[model samples]
Target chain A: MVERWPIVGMGAICSLGSTARETFDALCAGRSGLAPIRGFTTDWYTSDSLFEIDDRDDSKDRPGRATGFLLSVIAEALTDAGLSDDLGDVPVLVGTGLRELRSVELWRGSGAAVTPAELHFGAAVRSRFGAWDTHTFSNACSASLYALSLATDLLSAGEADTVVVAGTDSITESMFGVADRVQSIPPDAVRPFDRERRGTILGEGAAAVVLRREPGTGGSPRGWVRGVEVNCDAHHPTAPEAGSIAGAMRAAHQRAGVTPADIDLVMLHGTGTIANDLGEALAMREVYGEDLARPVCTAMKSMTGHTSGASGLHSLITALQSMDAGRVVPVPTLEKPIDEMSGFRLAREQAVPVDARLAQINAFGFGGINAVTVVEGNR
Target chain B: MSEQLFVTGIGVALPGADHRDAVLDPQVPEPVDPAARIGRKGLRYKDRATQLALVAAYEALRDAGLLSDPDDAKSHVAVDASSVAVIAASNYGNLDSVAATIDTIQQDRSTRLVSPINTPNLSSNVIASEAAIRYGLRGPNLTVCNGSTGGLDALRWAGSLLRAGRAEHVLVVAVEPDNDVVRSFAGTPRALDGAVAMVLGPARDEVDTKRPPQAVLSATQRAATIDDLLPRLGVDLTAVDGWYGPGGAAEHGLIGQVRPIELGHDWGTPSSVLGLLQCVHAAARFAAGATGTLLAVCGDPADGVYCGTLVEAPRQASRALTAAGHDAHR
Candidate 1:
């Protein structure tokens, strides 16, 4: 028998807004968060623009040089879920492919003493809440999505009544340096699924979702996390293998007792890279079949860019808000509705009305680590 | 709601030797010192990762009674490939490589050589790949990288796979080799080099089913933070044990009567293998009803903590007879 899982609370901070409500409003109005990069010294770096978070007031109050934009996004998620005041010492799982690479660079460049990213993150969370068991995972880009999978397992095993799952990564000069070295960072704005798409524009943000056995005392919940699956390609650390990516998605769908056809929408990892988008499209086609009119798919990364480790959770928040609002958020810019090379359907323009009860989110990171999470509406 | 998890096999490679009897006997082998020629003789040919895993996998397979049919390694999946994750807490990644790499760069930028020893040995995943190739394992492979929590996290991951029916026999290995970075950073507390391998499967034997069972693992753990759990378990971070230098830090008293062997006692450095050694020792003692209860608490000092307890049970004596039944099938 399937267990009845309930959504207690949710939170997020993305390019569109600092608060969950604000982000949801933007999503409803089909607002975009992408713009020219101005947060850091980009001339000395690689990419010219990114999904930087600097509008928020507290974003300026960050103590260190490499501001963990994701932490603020997590704070927003906690507040939205009514968990800001009362976290109640629950276990916290945070995933990031890059654990404060920016901070590490700042320390390296300035020669200033800095706290290790892992300890600093834990200390900050514990101070906000009480002492809680914490785990930080860095599995390339699949980090945060893998965190979600771990949280689900913990909750299913009854290890915790409530588990807070968060994924955050900041865009810094060092991130660009690495991306530039690898030739993965884009030259301009993101264009996922487009024929002219080049590469992923690095983005920064954080997201946290409070998962509990029952609805929290705080009132109504948005949606509950259902099934999540993770797998390593072990094929190539940098490039993803289509077979394994498809296997991961299938594993999650099977575990959830759902099918590819049952999915209402798909939140593509859509890193804006030609290889990544092509790999995802091939995987989706293999899993979902040749039916042209299948699940409505959209790439949120076009607006938010790739939020590094936080991209999974960042897109999840946007997808969840859409589920809550009963609409599908449109793409930031889809110049062409049907790219000749694209095999799946893509959504464009303002928010569209759709009945996608079940959806999937893909987060594939460096090292060929792939994590797929299947989210469903109340059946 | 309780699921039955069984200890079908175990592997261990320690300072003393790579045999189950040698590892569990508590009789220190003649060449116990790390610096002695006898110990250093093999250090040149084998990478520290290979030595640690080979010894641990041998002991585990012996304890599991899979030595006769080494190719019949179908029952277990390795949870981590990290040296620390697979072997011991102290012998994490090699520190000498880090020191040398940094030293070379500092001394002469263009003259430094980036050796293979400096590359693969520094990362923990090499051990997993090596073990897989050595044992011919093709099942689900994962390397838990949650710092100190790697050991327990590996166990948890194995448990999930077994419960989910993903694998019939899951081999959970935690190995750590001696490293230089850890030594300079914190003086290598109870650090030692060793590997602990366990075969996790469905509880079958009478001892596993009995109350106060041998190695009773509560999948549904109590929700407690790392800070609170450590204090409750009485884990003394200050007064170390097993290691030679100063000899202050100690494992939780819950793991009663381990008869720890201070490997390389003269060097004032204890082998990081003590934790795995102690775990195997306590589990064996508990199974034999020599101890009332024993607990192996694994966690990352920075984050997650997992606690596992083993209780005394006399019914496990029948395991020898059951071993024959499985042997006949092969």
Candidate 2:
């Protein structure tokens, strides 16, 4: 097994509050981040109840775009982690589902100037933290976790003692248009694992986590990355083979040196799309078997709507906070859970009482890319 | 646990031909004549990224003596795919979709040009996924996009997996297509199209018969800046046999007489893969006693240069030795 790497700090932004504490409180109160479609028109759109940022101030000198939103949230996350914007010494690994939609729009509109990578991450580091080593990761949904895993490698390999892993994606017209086409976004209400669930609502936000080899005397160790494993179906560009989903989970557990029994709960990617939900359920069943009393499964999509690349961290942040608070988050909108998938425990509105310390967060995306990260409270 | 991750086999498909051998000994495939690989039937439809990766993945597996049948690649995992995350690192995700959408939008009309291919392909991760599908890799399919460092970055990521006990075998593939957008950004005549892949696994006492030879990865370190690595690497520039770098008069005096072989000259844009191809070439040459210790430096005029070296051992040494008359000082 690879040496166990530690997660020294974390940052997150979603429909919830800008701070980790605020977001955690909102989650405990079961506050959903979903709302009516305002980012774009939904007159004929089939989905509703997307995770939208409320009271988003567009008055800043920042241009009105997805990037602006990302920068704002990243700023808030950096503050929480007690880090500057510069990432020179530390590798600044940024993840996003849709990278620079503004660049895409400009390229489409007037063939205008495109933003350089420096302008994005490079400039962000220079302007915010002062100086830093940086790189951008655009792997669809699993991008952030990939960044986290890389951070683990850097620390484990002694490349850097500390690394800043951040994930950000903005909601733009092009983003919605694509979401509309895929039918992954729902018209209203974010409901995951609901028998009548339709699809996910695209949400905009950024999340950051400061990973260090040694967590100085400060910081909470509620949720540390035990092991991270990534896999592809090698089958299709957009869909994952059912068996490989399980393979990915197995690999994560193997790397983390833990088992399904060691897991206390699981944060499902739960895109709210039928295929995604079913696929996740099948993977859980494959790994946990018919033991319905096994690891409790919950999802954050209802609370955060689909954050895309940031979804993994969104779930991770919630798991970390919930673990510290000594509670299990309910599967927010599971009106009627599927019966055919007759294994695994499902969380209700109130936190499920449990003593198990381990948790698993599953993030899968287009091109059949899958990553599973194991987390446990600091011993 | 930090054993050598050997390069058992290699596969390469360049401008002129496809082979399971290294091309370094003969000299960079004389800049593709008409660049025959460029506008071919299926090749035209593929984005430069896909084409570069396809060629390299196919060739790398072939070189490792494993591509004859689909089954040989089954246990392999894509180490680069997980580098960034998932679908975001796709070639279809970035170039094709954005380019098409941009083209359609410039018309002043609100035209929609979204396709599934765009989302999966433009993404930086697509190269890794495509490699997995092509080779049927079941273990650790991942991708990493760190710019100029991507090629070696992919190699290092695979090497880590081997060191950490993640997989028994891993496929490390790096391919960059020379898209018009990327080329214009680089402000160059476009690099050659190519792909380079290496099968990395732990060093073994006995060749398990189930696996290939073990090429140990001694060590790799990135400098805080270019200067920090130069003198520390023990590189004796004066004793060098060849200098493989960019083409054109602009880069002429950058390194004297070494005659920079523009692998991109014939290939156009996807030259990153050529770096690996160059490594294989050096390996073959060293094996043939034609040259010794080859230095491959790659970078855009804008960004600083990044160097990759292939140190040949014993009989497998590059042809540089015999070619340079085994001169201690040339």
Candidate 3:
């Protein structure tokens, strides 16, 4: 049997909060991290509001920002899990869905005293975290979850007893310029699934999870990553392919030994972009078919914006909060649901109370990359 | 361990090589026109890296019977498009496009000059994404940047996905475009830039027209060093037929010790996949009944470990098929 991976600890740093718990609480309270860019600026396109990780010194270089963000969350996760033993040999996998901000910065820097390793952001992270052996996944927004998938494979295959799966990316001037050029940034707020939704606001953040090899479940309930399914569109570079998205959902459910009817809630890749909303809604329908018993859905992108590579973990942690609170958090400004949203309940305005047992965190990105991870809560 | 895998087909688009007729000069690096070989439609906007990967991926697919002809690609796919996975591996990424866009903006001082369509090109995964789109491979599309072994690890990743029943077949492609800027930035001596692709299938299958396979692969794992990497094959390399090294500055003395049959003479981590092409080419030269094993190692300091795969030729692939058929008949 494939070994089940138990979630021992979780940590995150984003504009929503510096800690995962804080981020969860803020989302539950309907707080949005959208604001004018503070730490980063661009000349060609400067006014794009973003969910910037405030509080870090503005003058800090690119590597400093990214490294500090990653280490802070990893420390929190390790502490939360009570794993104090040496982690020198533990298998490590870090993912950056997009290009590493530091690599972009170093390349776009003044080109002085830049070491060769600095050009490879994965090496810098390895050096700082002392994870001499780590695999880096760079599959766009689904990167961290892919990293999670790799870690799960390691644990299931008995290659490692413990594994650290982490992801981090800070918005850079270049990133901002690209978003602005592509017109992906919203003019106002990120209103996912709303008729008035414009687009998503790019954000900066990091997330890490400590996964221990376990059979099914025999430990204190931190959480359970039952399984994750990944697939690609083979359709478009930027467009979300509902067929593959549906394929991933079906694969994840099949691997988790659960039927579509077993899903209690869904945290979608609701980037507030109409294309993504329509695509995801269609995929959900494809998975659930015409079943009357459909799961309620929520999106933290309304609160935390699009954290890019770190968005999947943010949604996972947020769902964990809902499981603990016994309420599905609502998306702000979701006054009118889009026409494509059907077969599932949309959580908006106020949090909805429900006894949810299984939840799926969805992350989709450029290259038609789709990832669906099933998590078991203490419901 | 899950079911064994066979290297059913390989596609290579190296600097002085082409997989069309299997001509490999292995000379100094030079630019190759992917558009010329693969056609120019829909490729005008892509980077050299993406184009190179697409060419290699198509060749590999054709070699594996997934594509019937080079002239008619979309109509010729023989495998289930929905059940095929694609994994693109690279270490340097598409620096050629990044540098080009940055240089253009610097020169023009206007972001307007850069096409908005190019925004997606900033990602390293774009190479794999393009391959999937062009080839209609909807299975687990992955992009790996694990230093030297990213290429092999991609093969390993595909193997695991296949074992888990995620896909029926997997296409693994690795590409590195020659960038003078990156070469000078690293102060490396070589201009190694090319792409290599492989199509892997289950060992127990009698689905295709070709022989079992050129080689069968063991599980891919991370080893401490070159010493640990090769021995994991459960045999001595001196007794084996050959070795292939895509090691960078981190693994200096490894080549002199292993004495590879065909020295890749390539630098950088992505070239490890190119080394794979070299190894496969040499193994194909073996007499039909000849038996041998080739150890392919790719490592870099950034990766901090060697990732190797053990390939057994005149491989035990037939044994796996026979056992499966025996069970079926019994």
Candidate 4:
């Protein structure tokens, strides 16, 4: 057997809560982070509703909202991993889908407090995590999922023994403009799997995790990242492909050396948009086939909203928390599940307890990027 | 463990009004001609960076015998691009479109004026995925935004794909388009418009295979200092036939005291790819003999993290991929 890459520590700062525990607890209780947009003001329609982090601190040292959020999670993740102040050889991989636009916004006055003329999203993370080296992935929303996979490859390929995979993005005016032009943002509550769901509610958050090659005994790990698979549909830059999405999911399970039957939980990349919900649900049914012994499925975007690059990591950590609690957190506002998702055992308000050993999280992005990662429970 | 990447094909497009393959000074700003691949008609509305990447990708694919000439039946390889993965490296993406979209937003105070096509180019992954969409590559399409060291980073990720058996060949391409917006705000004075493409495949051990390989590449290795990297590649620091570098980067400590020689032309914006392209061009430099070894090293000025690749031309001795260490770190 090869070296096991167990996630020794996890930290997250999203609209739901400031820490992993708070977010997990809130999500399990069916709480939502969606609210009126804060911080940066925009002239677009998205100003009415966004899952923006509450910017309580006006510190001059904070580079940008996203960078500040990223540092907080990385610090907590390092501390949680027991490495604390000793990050000697560990490489840092960051996936920020909107880093370019975010950097531009930072220069445009919102981040005037940020010092140093040239502030980089990934480089800022390097100093915070004490990483000797870093890698940046900007594959739109599927970025951090690719980062996690790259980290696993780094570990398995013997590049490094441990790695910190983290990602962060902030709702910016430019992105809001893009969304406004496309008219992809919902006017009401962000709802996934709901027949009346309009579109995605853009969100911002940061998540960090330290992965070790061997199972850690010093602290409680969220889960073990078994395998990650990524591919492109080559169909449309914006549209999701059902066949390719199913192919990515099956590939992940196959690489993890497991069958669909072995998966206990499936966290979807449900963006609440009509197209995404339908496409992802159809892909799920294709992967699991017609077997009634299907895995429990849920989508966290109903609460967290679409976290962009951080969505996949958030889903993985959320699944691990539910697995630790021996339950599955229901997808909030999932009334009137889509036709394609009706065949699966979709989670609703109540927490359904199950002996979930393996959990799979799927993330799809623009540019036809599709990523699926399988993680094993700490148990 | 990492495996060696056999270099089967290489293509490069240099900046200037003409967009030549070999440019003495590529610092001039000019978009590459889409030429016959997409033709002028297809790329009329496409951004400069996308057009450059498309052209380079087509050239590399053709050089690797993955694409057949419509007129020549004997040149037909009939290779399926769906099985080939793509890894693209870039620092700024299409800043031109990003600037236009942002400018339109400020000018009109509404996004309605921005073209739908220009908005998506803000994401750098569009540069990589656009090529995948055009070529029908179903494998992993990765985009790295690590500035100067991006080309090496893409090669490292490509090596990992080979080791994992995820793909048989990966088209590693890097393109930097002239963005007046970037020049005005971002202080990259040396930035130029250019695109480089290379095809990496599973390291071949057969010397007399059906196709003669351009070069055999060792797994890309990362080093804080040149001393650490040379030992891993099992080569003495000064033993290589030549070294290719961009400007004074080779002398910059991480690569040790090697002369900062510009092998052919190092005027490209993404200097790392320029260095790799220079190394590939050095294959023809050794006219006295058909055999030589060259080491290409590049360092990101932001951080001194160094990544180097050892290229053996018309080979002789070789070391296993696992023995030669490599890292795709930022």
- Please report the candidate that would top TM-score against the real structure: 4
- Runs with alpha carbons beyond 4 Å of true place in candidate 3: A1-4, A59-61, A112-133, A184-186, A215-219, A289-294, A342-344, B1-3, B20-30, B68-76, B104-110, B204-209, B230-233, B246-275, B281-291, B316-330
Q: What is the lDDT of residue A209 in candidate 1?
A: 78
The candidate scoring highest on DockQ is: 4
| Backbone Cα, N, C clashes tallied per candidate | 54, 88, 1, 2
Evaluate model 2 with DockQ and give the value: 0.28
Give the candidates in order of TM-score, highest first. 4, 3, 2, 1
Cα lDDT of model 3 by residue, B43-78, tens digit? 878887788888888877877767746466443366
The segments of candidate 4 whose C-alpha lies over 4 angstroms from its true place after superposition are A1-4, A44-47, A56-63, A108-122, A217-220, B16-31, B35-37, B68-82, B203-210, B225-234, B246-258, B263-268, B284-290, B319-330
Worst 10 residues of 1 chain A by lDDT: A58-67
Q: What's the TM-score of each model vs. the native?
A: 0.72, 0.80, 0.89, 0.90
Task: Give a tens-digit lDDT track for model 2, residues A115-201.
Answer: 433324434543455443555666678878877777787677665677777777766445555566567443466677778887777
**How far does residue B140 in candidate 2 sit from its true spot (Å)?**
1.6
- Indicate the TM-score of model 3: 0.89
For lDDT, candidate 3 versus 4, the one ahead is 4
DockQ of each model against the real complex? Answer: 0.12, 0.28, 0.38, 0.44
Using DockQ as the measure, name the better of candidate 2 and candidate 4: 4
Question: What local lDDT does model 2 show for residue A11?
Answer: 65
